[model samples]
Target chain A: MPIRGSDRTSNRRAGGSPQRRLGARKRNQESLSGDPESCSPSDPRQVFTRRYRASIRTGQEPPSQRCSKAIHQGFELEVQLYPLKSQLVLPGDSLTARFIDALSAARLSARNGDIIAVASKVVSLSEGNIVSLRKVRTTALARKLGRKFEMLPEFAQVVLNEADAVYGGVPGVLLTLKNGNAIANSGVDRKNALGDSVIPWPADSHRSAERIRRALNRKFRKRIGVVIVDSRVTPLRLGTTGLAIACSGFKPVRDSRGIKDLYGRKVQITLHSLADGIAGAAQLLMGETQETIPFVLVRGAPVQLGGSYSSNSMTLPVKDCLYMSQMPSPSIMERDHG
Target chain B: MPIRGSDRTSNRRAGGSPQRRLGARKRNQESLSGDPESCSPSDPRQVFTRRYRASIRTGQEPPSQRCSKAIHQGFELEVQLYPLKSQLVLPGDSLTARFIDALSAARLSARNGDIIAVASKVVSLSEGNIVSLRKVRTTALARKLGRKFEMLPEFAQVVLNEADAVYGGVPGVLLTLKNGNAIANSGVDRKNALGDSVIPWPADSHRSAERIRRALNRKFRKRIGVVIVDSRVTPLRLGTTGLAIACSGFKPVRDSRGIKDLYGRKVQITLHSLADGIAGAAQLLMGETQETIPFVLVRGAPVQLGGSYSSNSMTLPVKDCLYMSQMPSPSIMERDHG
Candidate 1:
């Protein structure tokens, strides 16, 4: 079941006067305006809405008893499945078109306060982020680094193919060839697309989200939210959870300091990653294989919406140090093709 | 803001056919004339209630712009904080008595479907789980193992004090001295409680929960759920979340397979962990330090009461390879107190 607001009553302690005030503000704002779009600028009221909800069909095992036990105690598990649609082929925008068409065929609509989750692979394919390794020239540094990391020739070729310019390289750590994303091999992809072609990360996911949101709103005649999601490695965790690479019409962070607990004790150093949580939930629906659900509808979330757009606000600086540096390089992108 | 259930429209997508059957079963059970004195068995029909609500407080900063964006996109954030109470002392029944008395003192006028969250520490103390490290006779193996783990002499003494027998140890891992908790130094405690004595892990938390539930029912003449909660180390996460060590008068698990999504896709492998979610919510009220709220009342959860108690059902075995192995251990009962 989707995590809901009523499940959080225990968090409101006896003497949380500060939390009460915040709750009152939100309640007041919600009461004053029935719809998010009606709120005026400088109202201090944020409005949010659901964009899309997709349910992927999969054959994965149910959560183990241990995982279920954890959930019973209040942690949530969300999965997203992205199965290759048979009607669409890779190496073209036809897949993107088909995906959009499928949503429309289903009569799926995005609304203001909705966050639509789209797979990064779909975005990459639509933007023609594919690279042909055969046309690329590899440098001496690439050769040495490839040998050290046991990287295959095709993988190295693909990495070199996507490079705008290669940064410094060590045996295992090949610096990014791009400025925006510092992923190994510059976020190149070799798997899941078409044959013999590698897909590079989308040029600007934030822009992509905004564009999609705008297009969907125009098509549906309603306001909507968009979240372009990718699976990223977290520091020290074994498996991967989805991350919101770009978002429109949502707040991705929450700060809880100077807040009082139920017993009236002040809360400090509590900032929650709201986007990551939702992304994780969406990922549960969008699975690794055999499940084709790409989008999820999130409703009943309390949030404020506005016309102003800002993607930089979601980017975490390298100095923050919360992210792990040891994420497996995009070598998997190249190695998977063979 | 607490995580609330999906709106009525979304319920069709959120609930499965099996869940619907379970809901039917619950309704039938509610209508049946069963003896009210016996504790009700927990089933899939129960919608676990969160003890805390994650909302913006007056003095607190709103969610970060990034998070706000996610929220605006229909992602929700619900947090629970469990603050440890400090006013009560340990190793005595009086603390339990006081807690029960305080609970009884609180008006018993809550609406139906309210749950009372109780901390495990107080239950452990009342059960005489506290130990005095100064009273132990340390073995040479204990000393050697203590040196390897950089354990303080007092902490080592506490471990020895609690053990019925000291088993041999590997290089970094300490074999349990008793009760198979597999904890460092047999789950000895030094911090959080007042004074120089240490505390051991609670024994038979399920029994404790059942006892407490029966006691409360007799006293209040009301049907309510009781959850005994403790903070546990998750395999992959950095920090701790509360777990339901034991529960009475509620179905703590939910199975959601064969459920149809909004688009009519079958949902498999989606069992909701109602108990753990409730426990985590309760933790928000039972803080580790400073905040003195150890109990919370949760209302409006959709669940059915049940008989039969099993704490072992909630324990995730260490054998799961997918589970993280390197979570930081809690400082309770096993800290270096020089």
Candidate 2:
């Protein structure tokens, strides 16, 4: 079955104002005529004629006009990451207000279905989550951890306090699981903080993200998703990419249980981590340097808006984690050559 | 240090033709004037005035005219993912040639500095890396393993043959380390394969990516990077996203050592997994289902082009893996609440 323009408009108009429906139609027409070739992969013209439609699905498109034309007269989807620069965020500052200010200052409005990815550091800074090393009381375990990982005892105490589970680490970095996500130093950091002070990842990042999302939604009167982005190192991988510590206003993962493969076989275990990918894309723009790009507006991301999901929707139990559960002993690991 | 247009042109024009230099300049000017506000984060006009110049850096831009306007005459970086739909690829097909064909058929020519991401499944298909389960002579160990994992003995044998180390499994999936990457059943799958056969991940994904890169470079005379992508499920995360099994023609990991954070502190232990982020972004476009998009052209990615790094540049030793190295015993893991 081909998805006609009428079908898309009808689905899109649901819960949307007649004015917005007219606006979307007007925008789509303008986009269709402007490039004539920038059709989405889900567009009926492309999906039905050139390729097989495993199923009919409609994805939300942001109002941004930037797109790359793929195949003459074909609709190709382009996910755009707009890194938003901000003023120096201070302790107890309103993150939602600051973000709204930044957007309006840039003359860009938050549209319906837009994703706002903010670095967790700024989120923590705004929450006044910083801890002074001088105020920290070190435990015996903290002192031992500091000696093992080459860190100050006060810093180690903070790490231990924030960590859900402490794992061994190479010198200078402690690996831990914080809120079910594997992170370095339990997402504690000294950079961008006062000397002799550190900031742990926001307490209950999921709730923080939801608070910001709710505020933004109320202010903008639009359906928007918010993801608290954090830089994380993966197992055996170098450098840091974005990880979603928390997400709100969308189903962060796409379940592909009933989806058919190219051969019509049902894909059993394919779940798309929409939040992580959005975070990674945002991290690509938010450099680790002194640039003030704390907020990234992700437009045209393929995500379902409006879902009541748990904050821990993306986390897995330690016993169920692939790398954690299946870790072999050192001798067994040494026997095989990678 | 402010990076001028002249500086970027000089750095980009090294070992290149005068014709291309003019083309890049013309394109940049057209892009600058067309949007007026479409400057790169590295663009001096934006970096010097509003944002702090942590350091001066210039990144490559593909020859695509798509970009979003940021700030009042500010330069913004827009990384674009173009998912490409290809014809049904059969065994013994020339992947490089087929990719070029797909690009040309779409009227999109390969551009210099463009990162091409190809699905590993298709690469295996092109290499005819399929096995008939009937031909496999499963050992007693394989039979037992199959019974435990609810897999056929022949399939378990193939997995054992490909895997470097097998730790454990849930009922239907076995977690194994293949080429230093933790994956399921050593990247073997029956989807899109013959009913009685399964296709394993390409034996040498790194070399395969290099092969594609060299062939494309020869054909287009462009310095392009190729990444062999495969969908992977992360630990404790739902849904699959793109993972780069092999990368060629660029440094897949960006070292952030000695870089200054926003507080002028020397940031350590931040290596950006450029390949993985690129793969994840491409995966966002390449659906897990019957969408025939096997290749995604990534443009405006913040990767330093023209490097001779090894294929395993993105991999880390198992002992050094954060999740693998620090995995606790069942008793220790059980005591902690995550």
For model 1, give the TM-score of chain B.
0.60
Which regions of candidate 1 fall more than 4 Å away from where they truly are? Answer: A1-100, A104-107, A157-185, A307-309, A322-338, B1-338
Candidate 1 local lDDT, B1-338, one digit each (tens): 11132121222123223444355345433432222322233311111111111111111222222232222222222221222223454466654455554443332233234566787767777788876666666667457657965665656656655554443332332333233233334555443554556666677767788887777677567676788765542211223345566788776644445644323444322344456556654553454543345565644333345556465544333322111111222222222322
Q: Which ten residues in a row have the lowest lDDT in candidate 2 chain B?
A: B329-338
User: How well does chain B match by TM-score in each candidate?
Assistant: 0.60, 0.77
User: Which candidate leads the pack in lDDT?
Assistant: 2
* Residue B195 lDDT (model 2): 70
**Candidate 2 local lDDT, B165-253, one digit each (tens):** 67677767777767877688789887777677888999888888888899999998877889888887776666676788889887788
Q: Write the per-residue lDDT of candidate 2 for residues A114-164, one digit (tens) a residue.
A: 899999999999999999999998878788878987989898888778876
- Segments of candidate 2 deviating more than 4 angstroms: A1-43, A46-74, A104-107, A327-338, B1-74, B104-107, B327-338
Please give me the total number of clashing residue pairs in predicted model 2.
12
